[model samples]
Target: MTETRHPMTGNEMSPESAGGMERHAYDVVVVGAGGAGLRAAIAAHDAGARVAVVCKSLLGKAHTVMAEGGIAAAMGNRWPEDNWEVHFRDTMRGGKMLNHWRMAQLHAQQAPERVMELEDWGALFDRTDDGLISQRDFGGHRYARLAHVGDRTGLEMIRTLQQRTVQLGIDVFMELTVTDLFQDDGRISGAFGYWRETGRFVLFEAPAVILATGGIGKSFKVTSNSWEYTGDGHALALRAGASLINMEFVQFHPTGMVWPPSVKGLLVTESVRGDGGVLKNSEGTRFMFDYIPDFFRAETADTEEEADRWYDDKKNNRRPPELLPRDEVARAINSEIKAGRGTPHGGIYLDIASRRTPEFIRKRLPSMYHQFKELADVDITAEPMEIGPTCHYVMGGVEVDPDTQESAVTGLYAVGECSGGMHGSNRLGGNSLGDLLVFGKLAGEAATAYATGLGRARPAVAEDDLRAASHSAVAPFEVEGGDNPYAIQSDLQQSMNDLVGIIRTAGELERSLVEIEALKERARSMAVEGHRQYNPGWHLALDLRNMLLVSESIARAALAREESRGGHTRDDFPQTDHEVWGRKNLVVSLDAAGTGVELSERPLPEMPDELKKYFDEPRKES
Candidate 1:
């Protein structure tokens, strides 16, 4: 596909033109307004930093609001035996022990406090009879550790944080998409972006910048992610010379809708199973019971009575088969479908309709009921929902120090889903929301402390560099005729879904690389027809650059890691080769050519004896 090139003189604003153009400077500039961004802004403001939160969407409408599973925190409500130590162990095991121990430890230790902080900030989580936050059972969690708000946990969390930040008077730049990071003298100086409403470029000069811009799921076809999840933060950080770790481990959620072609990939929240839904084949057999791995065999129930009993008394029995970790369940469903036991739609039936009362289903899963009715024309409360795997989360992202949340670049930082080495291979359901809150606060504190020590040193930003970035951002729109940006995006997604998807092999990955290169070439010639106001076409055009860059990094990292570990499973090399591939994390950087990212090895984090104790205990009930 070819795009028409329109040669128009530049009306784009330079940084100098932005001088009198409402140029707002803050002590910290946050590039996303999701849960992490809001929390980070609040923390920075509390630490005496003038903070601003920038987002691509309207306030309270971040992709974080779409998360349905609850936040994981060991609050000891459902399981008195649950604690941070147990939480840490489950996280590590769920990630296949590839998780950064220190990061996991910090996340586990700090999660409960973060949950309470949200409550104090006015989040109305479900309450137990005794008045503490109520907890729910989620896949891979030994205890009912997830604190939620009726399957709308993300909405409650984001709404509460947004409200709290607004009351605190934090400056917010809604509907602004960051285009480039401005750096000078080996430190971050500021950033440049476009205002979607006015179609004007804006500059933010700040010594500290926080990237809480979520994941890169939009890079794939059939993802349960919003259009905003385009690897912008990961791309921006990488372009600023920051190293990314574990970009290969992308998580595919097992239960996305799979009937209608258009909305087939939308996420069917895990809350369905948490409320006693079952995954069944065409013959009505619960298939997960026969596919338990040794790692999870002790915790899972093979029988219906045991699974039911376990929900009430987790100490004596095992978890329901439907509650297996996402990776295991996804693989099992794939196998069943391949064996001709799948439903007519090629997906297994996720049925809660027959088992639970309609009132209870409606109360526990209102959004699921609404989404299915509106999008798929199926009443989830009355029928089994057809479900399959869809690209959901990126487990690997920009590598940062576990405690500091600081990347290799001194002034650069990453938090939430954009940062890596936290979830290892497969993230347990409900862990991500807690991960965002805990690390978002840490990133803010660390950045504030660092900024405090170095007071008001303005790094030099070049006008030419900023102008070049601005022009680059607007270049696709300048093309009068060419390949459609949407078409290019569609092609990219299809390519990723076909070759770089759940099960990958060497030949398939290589083919994916070739397809990516072709798509990148076509993207350069892509055209945008509409004006910039709420223009999804324009937004997608800009996001394509980040998607292609991050996709290359992911593919490169996957090729380098020879063993099957975590989310990266190489069919050619099926076994986990811990002796060699296990020791070091793959870190990627730009090569001498300044084009493709170079992969280097960094040592796996050392877990102290105290921290390692959590892993030594057998998960079997005493």
Candidate 2:
């Protein structure tokens, strides 16, 4: 194969490109440099395959770094009874049993080993008294199962993975956003993207592509996600003929800063509650006990006394109502606010000050301490935090094979928050981190095998496709006197937040679809000012397409699933229909005309008797 080296930039040029654009060739290309992307790259390299990791932001700055709750793994360090089977059960039940059984099974069985691997690679987690890795309690698990470093577990995990990636000489393309995926026939051939800083086009010619881009929380008006979570990977996969599953189930985290306009939607980690904080209403009443759902009643404590005691004696007492799954807690908080019992800022209070000592709070929750002190000027050790629900995680993404993390489209893989079905309807706290590591490794190795299996017969990206992608990427700059991308984005966010948020109705979902259609029309005429060189306006314009497509998917899927379950709560349906909705998973793909979204249903994969017995057996309290 002959390649030309560009004059100014040291990038290779593909012979098919008449316009000598920057190009790279690798066995596997991994998009999004978060935990899953980094882990995938490492795994691919270990399998003796050339790998490239592409990121939308600077290295080590993906949303994975914002994960403060910890990595969930049944290490059994805190409670000797904890194991993968218990974890598997907790995960399935927490997700409202909508999870892909095999994915959940694989995650539960491999998470502990992944955590140990991270530790072996230089992650310094908090230690137990016996010199073992200490574990902390999170929402759904029976035992203390999260391995963490205070409130900075994600930071440590990213640091370790980033270091390992660098040490192994895996190539990483930072600040490059993939706009489209190239497919030769029905198989992935390459990826097309541009550098964020310079706006120069770049292409990765590879037989396999792994999408690890995180969630789509930014589509909402109030979200804990950063600017980069615009559903890029989800849209790319859908446009490439890969179906998305469970798009309706979007997690609204119960605790996000609701005071001070500037930091309203910032995340307040679940670690606060796991470490002994409690939720209270404006009347200073511990209100979580009153809102416990019937589904979790048997395992959850009914009274504050038992709930408080369970923190110390997990073997004898039930878990606290405050530690219920996120969907339950978020809905409960919303109920309090709607019932006129909320604080002045339209949120309830999360108080750790009254429950734990100041020293302990600072040590276990240093980030929360500083985040509150610096952002809100409310010392978390002395005063309660005013927080409300914020759009957090998306439990929906590209449909992929549970064993390999490969999508329906050949040679295309997805993992992390971009891949669906691991968390069913709602995700348990701390599972995100573990999901990243476990599936990332699986996808990386599988993509490598697929790439290497082709031997000398690799697919090539076409010149006409490259030209079309380039024209599309630069179209916003050509429009004059058109709609502002920022204004359209803001309107889209408002529409989603009001019509398709934590609670939804058929009427609202229908209205949202209508609004989204109008927004798509406006997005077509979106114009950006100035050249693409480091222009934020142009970037936002490009990202709007992805956000709109994903938002529509969520609205359409939510409208079809006329039942309340986990993250996809329908106020109209009001109850979970375990018979119909529970048995089928909603899928979203481009219509036959390749214009609008088409929604369909597929039966949930049956779990074999051997694995199904875990759920049927008696609940193990210990």
Candidate 3:
């Protein structure tokens, strides 16, 4: 509530003697300015709460802006028969039914209205011939269900949300990274972070804090994620006493650019296939047909002719196997590369230019046309793209109550990719955008209601706790000699990539645990040079803690879930054990001593008979 001078610079800032933080007070504090954070802030403000959104990056640079696919919503625009019930079935089956049925139902039921809300707030979606929002085809969905822009849906979505937040007068704190969440009497009250530019500490005092800080993809070497995807929220939630569920389920998207080393792991949107792209091996074979699993056989096309025809007549013919869920596609690609059926690079070929008209290709996927033409010498309208599987998303995150999106920690709510349960073992394409909108709104409203009920009584921050957090943050700079932070980070990435990647074995996972322990030790002793002002090394040092903790949790959880399911593939245990594992959720939490992670089993809630009835009946067709 008061401002003072920095200790070293004597510049006007929060004083060092009293925690040295520029304190801010809000009813709801939302972290990360991505789709979820922005949406949450908007919802909170609309619900009559004082709201603020904080992020470590500039407003538009969040990972959500890099999204290429559309927002999945069963709006019945392209397919009038498409409805929420059908959407719910697709989502549950796509998730392999590992989701909290209530969460999946809420998302499916609310996503349509959320998308329409974006339109009402000024998002100009691509339209159909009848002037309705045009929906496109995506894997695992029965209807053409994704409402997108021309390969830039994320850009448009972020732009709209950002505009809405600004128009509603929500405060934004850009380039600030929170290191620890503060609790008072077992309730989440505030957070401790510092400015990315100056490294001066900042404190946010709020009744509710929304953890929308996204996922942990940066821990993998070949990932489509940006630098900010360090699992900050996941680690913060764990440290603040919230459990993580399904930590082993990390999604490896099948179509990532693989030609040039520089562009490796860059995402190739699913919209390419939605608009009629095909996958091929060096032998000119549509390999997806051979890789189709028995689970999806009834719904997928068996031949290339039928697959091609289904694109035009989806109602009568089954969809292509290329439209199978991401886990299946990624595994198929990995197998092809391992079996020597890959292209010149260690990836397979995705040929769209050979099939679609150049004009249509340019219109439907403008960004892809440019990205391929500029990055690689190949023209997407005339040549195939070198594509492979890449680490894209983690379906695991802070476990929350399905109804409120509130974590076990009373005032700490999580949504978007940072919150678990909505997308079970693996997420379907286009679902991420919809998930953000639906849950972000719910979390925002819930957090607001909780904050309002708390009244004018502010949660107190202990001086000892603030001092300890401050000391720990600055300790890296004090060490005279230690391991380099960047080296440790790079090593952690390689470890996850090689050992805990798409295909895993018992031996490999065991080795990964040993390696992760060493990495954590190195991170703990890592030192940084230079004063705190805009120092990349110091920033890396702070981020290392969260990354290591999250990586360790992922490896530990992966090792324990000994079954091959959606994204967590176990070579030794090659089948999904529904009898045992399916009935339980692998919950990850800090040990009572806060010294290490503890894994436990909790029974998954049974789906209500009313909702279960939909799945037992014949698949819904409009």
Candidate 4:
């Protein structure tokens, strides 16, 4: 495709017109109104600091609401033998031990409390007969560790936080998308963004900033994430000189709907498998038994009877191979498909219809039933669902202290999927919600404490910077003639999916870089026709900036790793290069290239003996 330049004019507020800008000062500014952002705002408010929660979307509709799997926590309900140590081990093993030990430990220890706090705040989760929150088994968890409210755990969690936030009267700036972080004297002062409703620039000057802006799945062709998962926080933090870690590890969900070209690939939630669904190829074979590693061999079932029995009695029988960690399941399906065992649709069938009755399927997997019926025109109740892998979560993000949730950039903090080293290379299913709750609270507490210690020295928000950022954010719409933003976005997604997806080789990574550069050039000339109210064109244009930045980071980091581990697999360098690569993390920073964004390496924090003790062996059932 030829690159086209569109004639454009700046929105009335150019940098030259605004001589000086007015600043609104707050003690803390939390960017992103998702679960982490809301939690941070509430914590900051409770810590006696004036706080503001800024989001690009409506208050209740942040990407957190889209999460379907349950939150992982060691609540010790059904299995009294389970504890934080076992949870910690499972997390590390699932992540391929690339995770920071302390972070994993802290997350496991605090997750139960965080889930309980959500319950206290009026969040209703499906309950056990004993009246505690109900738990279910998810991939990578040794026990039934995920506390859930059916499959809509994130909806319940976010709604509870949103309602609680309203009651607390925390200042919320909804429909405002933060374009840039304004820094003063090497510390983060605040952020500057534009209002999508009015196309006006708003300035927030605060001592502390929390980035909970979620994941980067939108950069790929297919994803489980919503439009908001554009790596905004990651991009903004990178531009402001914060270090990002583990950009190479992107998780490909094992079951996204395949076939329709228009709806593309929509995520079929993993909760289906958690509820007893099995993955089968067209030949009707239980394929995962062929892919089990020696490490998991003892626990995984090889026969249908054993698998069914395991579900009923997890303690006495072997676990189902279908419930292996996401990475394992994805690779198994990939292998089967590659060997010509795939269905006619170029994907395998996830059959829950045969395992359970239609009534049971409808009640348990309601969203799955609804999504397939509405989008794919298939009722999962009678027929097996066609599913395949799609890019989903990034195990890597801005590196932070496991205890404080403070990034290397003194005044900047990150929580949720934007922060790295928690899940390491491959995240365990159901653990993401728990990670958000645990670290969101930590980040909020840390930011509030940092703000409190600073007294009241709010820095100035420069008019020139605000105007420049606002124009950059809205420039795509101003382009009168050029490639459509949606077109460029689709191209970018395809490039990422084709070249930088599930399996990577050096040649493909090189091709992806070239393709990305060309796509980015096209993005600069993108045009939009609609006015700004709920304009998807405007949203895609803004999201493209984040997607480009994150995609580049992922490709560069993947190129540097030179080894296969967890979510990052190299066709050429097929083995894990632990001798050189294991000791250090591939850290991407803006300073390394003199372009204000750079990539380098940093040593992983040494695991203390206290924390390492948990990894001695898999917890034995007493």
Candidate 5:
């Protein structure tokens, strides 16, 4: 074996037995190649930073591509009355007033510009009759606000961002998994990981690291997320001394496929409803009218006729209850299923076929049309879809500075779904894509500024820390008669799905914590039979560490928040407590021993008196 010295740290490094080793140095190292990551890389590179984007999956395959609806922005192309202040109010109210005020303000104000920027970079969104980028209505928005390309807006976004990154010559390291973030003197030093194909060790020596690794949906048994979203970014940030908030508020998108065991939990985008689809019970009754909450009753239509008329004459009628915030919709569906009013396959019906003609459905929702036809042998254009809530997004993530996107740990930044406080208790549909663009650019710029300010002198990765990361990566292969990682993962998913899922209770959450601990114990001796190369079992074993930590955080946070608000619904504490739980958010961090997590309460920042006026009176749109 040949020993080589790291140029920056002067540390002796040798290839581990499992695979060859490679080292790279950059000013900013970005983890995850999703929309947020690519957008960040572009911003950093444009700012003249030597940036590298590392992802577990190939370029263009990030979870962002799975987004079907549209990017939320107050472009006002479709609704002349729509603007940033209204958008901000909708976001804050949609999140149950738990969102970071400054973040929400920035997001709503900047989102329109970001969407326009994408158009300048070659994104081809569907246009309106007058020939401007068309906006579509979605949950929680007062106007048609989402700038989209039919039901494949996310695909267009990734394509546009990826193209921009390539044109800028930013280096992208695809199919690489980052297992650990190394910090020196409480600041980010670099990141360590391995190539997925060969399992060869790779080191990124950088002054700044930005995590945009999407959500924790894969931790649930039923989810719209792909396998790559194992909560790596959340767990990595926590272990690196950053804190996470809102972990309990997991968004179960109200419409996931609930038929054909093979395709259960697949996303049925809210755009279906935005484009006129309606939900019905097995009795063919539009049940959303019966479930409209008092809070939304002022704006939501209580009658089916008014709801249907509002689609064409928004100025005259209240919006449909079907377009309520995701949390409300998901809970309503869960209640319907529990009451035995569900379809034969155990879900409610989303019927656009009856509301829209086949030609119109195909024109507006091409992807949903093909997705159902190809995956489940169902024709969405002809019949209603059997749909239920599925674990879709985690509003909780690494807590960061609202302006800079910098985490508690210096030189470490997080954006998009990996960062918290923006969405609060729940996120509005279409706002996610907007958050990625607005904050992705902000994080990239801030990280670049921090990195370049360090000049030639930068923090160095410790040799011992590097060795420990390598050992942890290979430990599963050396264990004797150890536990199965897949089995542990399966049990953890089931426990989370049944206990800490869409609705929660103190008893169930406490039980979930116990189960998580038990799984963590089993994971200690997780074993794999094959060599690191092409070993999925080993990959899963490694991912289990992240999933366990995130799971614990979610359960612990869920138990701490005793009030039902937004995505966190508790049967024991069913009412929102404005004086207590609503005033603060539970923040999670690694305990002193670094073996477990500890929770603390952080007070929500007050919104300025000027901005507060937007919510003081309800303005009727004309």
Candidate 6:
């Protein structure tokens, strides 16, 4: 016997038509209007489902706009020999063999289609002599493979997707923040949140929800992440009965702006390096050659002459050491600064002017030139930019089924930076935007099929749960006087920065866990002065809870791993324990009471001989 969908007041109805607190009825509610969310909503809509897109900021101001490097795809536009197999090999190697084999395969196979689709939908990319999409060199790729638009690739991508979303008539609820997910009887029902500008409560009754809320980088004091990245999606998934995997893997991008204290964490696009920028220490040495790791030694050049030759004839020459994956490069820069070879601002120098012509630098990296010139008083066309590491992205997120992108919770899906199991322990450069398109489409299609299959059956929202959620949201404002939310937030960021930064120690991680507990208490006692309407204080107060919880998750997972792997480096245990930690992944989920997170170790899913044979080939030169 088949159970039919329960009849409800929220079927194909507008907010005004729906009764009592029900804002709208959507078959799918896609949170975050960034690359992943927009792509998901578009896919769901194309699948004949009504979709609603909830964005915390304005439509165009999503953090995806900050992505400057090109999107990675083996289109073979530049290097005719490049293909999906080579791309897969590069991805697997870049992740240090910790990536889920199936996801990497799928991403490589499907990426070309997605990039071409973007072009079909009015995305104007840089072009080649033959008029095909132009691809360029990036870290961890075997060939010139990132399709871009100078340094504004992200801007063009977002514009194209946004235009497509509007063209399809997808309902976009801008300036909204989804703080809590509503579930009933072991299934997800809908979500509850508030408008950022008006602060009025909003409810969406949907059978399926996709979380694409980016990363947790803002937890650190120095980060390239924006204010919205406070781990909302990661925490919401944990509390909603979905486990998180690889929570310890946080990528510190190697070349963020390090001068002008006001702009210390701003990202310096990898495009500069892709266009022939070189890194040098204050001693006027090209120090990258001295820092190449053994993993990449076979592929990297041993001399400056060979490296420079590779720039013109890559097929015959080796790759420069500066093109190593982010993890190696970031650690190298950190080493240089610690060894007292750093600039006055504690960063090494990236010199493009000395290597490339002024016209070429300005033409290829307009944003980089202007950013350094305007922000740090450095003319990038004539001088070098001081650069260092900064918290960039988290490779760990909600654990989802590789094929469907569905979480453990029924009716819940995740993709992009908030979902795990794509890049593994470390992400390769230019892979993030590619990940967004490939998995975002899958999550959306899967959620729509799951919802449409329900045939109108909806999960009932329990009154007790709704009341508790409402109270928790309003508690801070009702307290009148208590701990200031901003202060607690600042303290949390500082603790995470000092105790659990790029290079960690056992004692520091233990201390971070302790400080996280104290910050949790501070979060509970948080007080907001203004009304909910346009109240940044109240918003921070709410976001503080998510950040505190996610920070503790990262620290605890880092401690449990007991070995350095990818982005997680421990001074006490500096070696990579491939036999132990490499075979296992740390999973984090809520306890039965939904009050705390619990950790467990699980072996990764296996790859069969047929698929595993891909690795049998000699590793490509990256």
| TM-score list, all predictions | 0.94, 0.98, 0.97, 0.92, 0.97, 0.96
Error (Å) of candidate 4 at residue 6 is 36
Write the number of the candidate with greater TM-score, choosing between 2 and 6.
Answer: 2
State the TM-score for model 4: 0.92
The list of candidate 6 runs beyond 4 A from truth reads: 1-22, 620-622
Q: Per-prediction count of colliding residue pairs?
A: 7, 0, 1, 4, 0, 1
lDDT of 6 by residue, 1-59 (tens): 33222132123444342334435678899999889999999999999988989988889
User: Candidate 6, which ten residues in sequence have the lowest lDDT sum?
Assistant: 1-10
Q: Tens digits of per-residue lDDT for model 5 on 232-315? A: 999999999999999989999999998898989999999999999999999999999988989888888888888888887676
lDDT by residue (1-622, candidate 3, tens digit) is 6866434323343344366467767799999999999998999999999888999899888899767879999999988888898889889888888988898899889999999999999999999999999999998888899999999999999999998887876788888999999999989889889999988888788879999999999999999999999999999999999999989999999999997999899999999988999999999998899998988888888988888888766755488988899999999989999999999988999999887999999999999999999999889998899999999999999999998899999899999999999888989999899999999999999999999888878687788988999999999988878999999999999999999999999899989889988988877788899998989889989888888888988999999998988899999999999999888889999888675688998898899999998879875322
When summed lDDT is taken over every stretch of 10 residues in candidate 4, the lowest stretch is: 3-12
lDDT by residue (tens digit), candidate 1, 317-383: 4889788888888878888988999888889999999888999888888899999999889998789
Off by over 4 Å in 1: 1-22, 312-315, 477-481, 529-535, 620-622
Please report the candidate that would top TM-score against the real structure: 2
Instruction: Write model 2 residue lDDT over 217-238, tens digit each, in one string.
Output: 8899999999999999999999
lDDT of each: 0.85, 0.93, 0.89, 0.83, 0.92, 0.88
For residues 236-311, what per-residue lDDT tens digits would candidate 4 score against the true structure?
A: 8888888899999999888888867565567778889888999999899878888887668877787888899877
Candidate 6 — number of clashing residue pairs? 1
Which residue pairs clash in candidate 4?
589-598, 590-596, 590-597, 590-598
Error of 6 at 463 (Å): 3.2
Give the Cα error of residue 582 in candidate 5, in Å.
Answer: 1.4
